[model samples]
Target chain A: MSLDLFLNQVVPVRQKLFRFAYRLLGNEEDAQDITQDALMKVWSQQEKMPELQNMEAWCMRITRNLALDKIKSRKYRLADELDRAGEVPAAQHNPHAMAEKNDVMGKVRQMIHELPEKYRTLIQLRDMDGYSYQEIADILELDMNDVKVNLHRARKAVREKLQNIQVYGL
Target chain B: MDYNQIIAILDRYWEGETSLEEEALLRRFFSEPHPDMPEPLQEAVPLFGYFQEEIANEAALPDMPEIPVVATSSARVVRLSPFRHWMKYAAVLLMAIGMGYAMKQYQQREVKASLAEIQQQKLEAETRMAYLETKKALELLAKNLNKGTTQMQKLSYFNDATGIITGTN
Candidate 1:
C-alpha cells in the first residue's frame, strides 16, 4: 500500500501500541521508546510491507520484537533504576479505597505481572489488544489452537491467583 | 449455585473448545453481579472484571505514533545484501584511489613538463648569450680595424707632410 494510506490507517493505532508496550514493560518511558523505535522501523520498511490483511498486527509484531529485545538487553533496567531512585512517580496506591476497587484491581495487576512472559504476552494480545485467536497466533507465531489454549490457561492462572489472593488475603 | 454449567464451559475453555461467542458468554456470566455464584467463581469475578476493564480500556489507550506505509508493490524482504554492501564500499574506495593515482600521475607529468621547459629555456638563454658574446667580439674587432685604418691614414698624411717639407727644401 502507499505510504499515505498506510499512515492514515495505521498511524492512529500508535497509542494502543504504546499502551500494549507499557502494559508489557510496566514502564512508560520504555514503552514510549519502544513505540517510537517500532514505528520508526515500520516507517523505514514501508516499502516491503506485507498485504494489508493486518497492519496493526504487523506493527504489534514489530513492537513485540523490539520490546523483547529491550527486555533481553536489560536496557529497561535503567528505567527500573530510575523508578527505584524515586525519579519516577509511583503508581497511586489509594489506601482508603474500596476492597473491590483497589485490592482486587491491585491483585489482578500483580497476578498479570506474575504470569510467564509467554502467557502475559498472549493475554495482552488477546485481552488488551483485542486480537482474534488467529491474529494472536499470527503475531505470536503459534498455532491457532495453541493460541486459544495458551490464552485460556493464562486467564485461568490469573483467575486462580486472584482467587487465592482474595481468599487468603496474603 | 449452578457450578456444573460453569464448570462444563470452563472445561471447554481450557481445552480450547469454546468459541468466541462461548467465551463472551462466560465473560458476561462472570461479570454480572450474581449472588448465587460459588465462592471460587465469585473470587474469579474480579479477574474477569479486570480483563473486561483492560479490553474496554484498550480503546482508551494513548495515541500511537503513525507508522508510515511502505509501498509494497514490489514487496520483497529487504536484507542488506552482503555483496551489495561490499560493492558499495569497494566502488567508493576504488574511485578514491583511482582519483588519487590519477592526481599523482598528473602532478608527476606536470613537474616533468615544467623541468623540460625550464631546461629548453636555459639552453635558449645560453645560446643567446653565446651569440651576443660573438657579436660583441666582432664589433670590438671592427672597432680595432677602424682605428688601424685611421692610424694608416695618419701615417700617409705624415708621409705627405714629410714629402712636402722635403720638396720645399
Candidate 2:
C-alpha cells in the first residue's frame, strides 16, 4: 500500500485502537502511546502494507503486542492494580446512584483484571470491542473454535464473579 | 426489549450463541432501565453499561509525529563511518598524546645538537691553545741556534788573527 493509503485508511482507526489498548492496560497514557506507536509502525511498514489482508485487524494486533510488551517491561507492576487507575475520576451521574454504580463497575473491572490473559483478551475483543469471532481469531492468531470456547468460559467466569459481588457484597 | 425477551437473550448470551448484533441488542437493552425490568437483570446493568460507556467515550487520538522519508545516500554514510561517537574522543586523545611525545623528542634532539656544538667549540679552543704553545717553543729554539752561530763566528775570528800574524810580516 502507498503511504497515502496507509495514512488515510489505517491511521483513522486510532481511536478504536486506543480504546482497546486502554481496556487492556487500564491506563490512558500507555494506551495513547501504544496506539500512536502502532500507527507509526504501519507507516514505517507501508511498503509491506499491500500484503496484509485486513488493515484494521493488523493495527489492532500490533497494538495488542505493543501493550503486552509494555506490561512485560514494567518491572514492578502490581497485580490487579494499575498505577494510575485511582486518579481517574468516576463517571458523573446522580451522586447517590453514582457511588453504587462506581462500586459495581470497580468490582467488574477487578474481575476482568483477574482473568487469565487469553480469556480476558477474548472478552475485551468480543464484548467491548465487538469483534467477530473470525476477526478475534485473526487478531489473536487463534483458532475460531478456541476463540468461542474461551469467550464463553470468560463470560461465565465474569458473570459468576459479578453475581458473587452482588449476593455477598464482597 | 420486554423483560421476557431480554431474559431469553441473556440466556442465549450466557450460552455464547449471540451474534455481534444480538449482543449489541442485549447491551442496549440493559444499558437503560425499564419500569418492568427485573432486579435480577438489574445486576447485569453495570457490566453492559460499563462496556457501552467504555467505548462510547470517544477519546481523541493523540497527535502523531511525522516521519520524514529520506532517500538512500551513499556518500553521507561513507563520510560518517570512521568517526563514531566514542571513537572520535579516543582519536583526539591519541592525537594529543602523540603531539606531546613528538614535542618532547624534538626538544631532546635540540638539546643534543646544542651540546654537540658546545663540545666542538671546546675542542677547537684547546687545539688553538696547543698550536700557539708549539709556535712559541719553536721560535725560542731558533733564537738559541742564532746565538750559538754568533759564538762560533767569534772563535773563528781568533784563528784568522793568528794566521794573519804568521803571514808576510
Candidate 3:
C-alpha cells in the first residue's frame, strides 16, 4: 500500500526535487545526490506519508534541508555565476545584438545571484519554478504572509537594480 | 494583448500581486521580440528572458535514472557475499595470532626465570655444604693438637722429679 503511494506521488516529483536541489547547491552532481538521499529519507519515514497534506512540498523541503546540511558540512561554494553567465542562449540573429542580449542576460543572472539567499530562493521559486506562495511557504517552512513580504522585497530589490542598470549602466 | 493591458499586468507584477496566469502571460509576452517595445516594459525583458532560458535548461536536463523499488512481495532477495566483511575477520585473526604469540613468549620467559632460580638455589646449597665440611676438618685438627700438648706437660713433670732425687745422693 505504501509502495503504491510512493510510486504514485513521490516518484513523480523527483524532477522538481532535483531542480530545486540543483538551484540550492548550484551543481548537478550534488543536487542529484541530495535528491536520492531525500528520496531514501522519505522512504525511511514512510509512516509520516499518510499524514502529509502536501507530499511534493514535503519532498522539496526534505531536499532543501539535505542540500543545506551538505552546504554547511562541507562549506560548499556555489558555482560561479560568472562562469555560467556565458551560457545564455543567443536570442538575436545579428552578432552585435546577440552579444548585447547575452551581456544583459548575464547581468540579470548576476543580479539574481547577488540577492540574499532567502530573496534569491524566493524569486527563483516564484518566478522561475512558478511555485505558488503556499507551496513555497511549505517548502521553506515560512508563513504565507512572510513569503509574500519577502518576495515583494526581493522583486523590489531586483527592480531597483534593474533601474540602476538602465539609468547608469552600472 | 494590448500594450495598455500588458503595462497594467506588469505594474501589478512589480507590486507582487500578479497571479500565476498573469505571470505566465507576461513571460509569454516577453519571449517574443517587440520592435516598438514600450519603455516601461523593456526592463522586464532580460529578467523574463533569463527565467525562460533557465526553464528551458532545466527541461533539457537528462532524466534521472530509474530507482529500483521492491513494489511486489515476490521481490528477490539479494545474496550478499561472505567476504563482504573480510576486514573484520582479518582483524580478529590478527588479534588472535598476536595473543597466542604473546602467550608463548610469556611462557618461555616464565620457564627460563624458574630454571635460573633453581640453578641459583643449587649453587647456594653446594656452597653451604663445602663450608660445613671445611669447618668439621678444622675442628678435628684442633682436638688432636690439644691432646699432644697435654702429654708433653706430663713428661716435663716426671723429668723434674728425677733431677731432685739425683741432687740428694
Best by lDDT: 3
Per residue, candidate 2 scores C-alpha lDDT tens digits across A13-39 of: 777788778767766677888888988
- The sequence of per-residue lDDT tens digits that candidate 2 reaches over residues B90-122 is 989999999999999999999999999999999
Give per-residue CA lDDT, model 3, range A43-145, as digits (tens): 9999999988999999989999999999999999888866576565546578897888777877887898889988999998999888999999999999999
Residue clash pairs of candidate 2 = A1-A50
Question: How do all the candidates rank in terms of lDDT, highest first?
Answer: 3, 2, 1
Task: Give the per-residue Cα lDDT of candidate 3 at A58.
Answer: 93
Name every residue pair that clashes in candidate 1. Answer: A11-B66, A14-B64, A14-B65, A15-B62, A15-B63, A15-B64, A46-B70, A47-B70
C-alpha RMSD in Å of predicted model 1 compared with the true structure: 16.1
Candidate 3 at A139: error in angstroms?
A: 0.7
Per residue, candidate 1 scores C-alpha lDDT tens digits across A40-152 of 88888887665557778788888888888888888554233234244222565664545446556666766776789889888766644456888887777789888877887
TM-score list, all predictions: 0.59, 0.63, 0.70
Candidate 2, after superposition: displacement of residue B47 in Å? Answer: 0.9
| Model 2: DockQ vs. true structure | 0.28
- CA lDDT, candidate 2, residue A160: 89
- lDDT by residue (B1-169, candidate 1, tens digit) is 4677887876676555676666677787877778677764566577677787766654555565444445567668978867768878899999999999999999999999999999999999999999999999999999999999999999999999999999999
**TM-score, structure 2 vs. true:** 0.63
What's the residue-level lDDT of A98 in candidate 1? Answer: 52
DockQ winner:
3
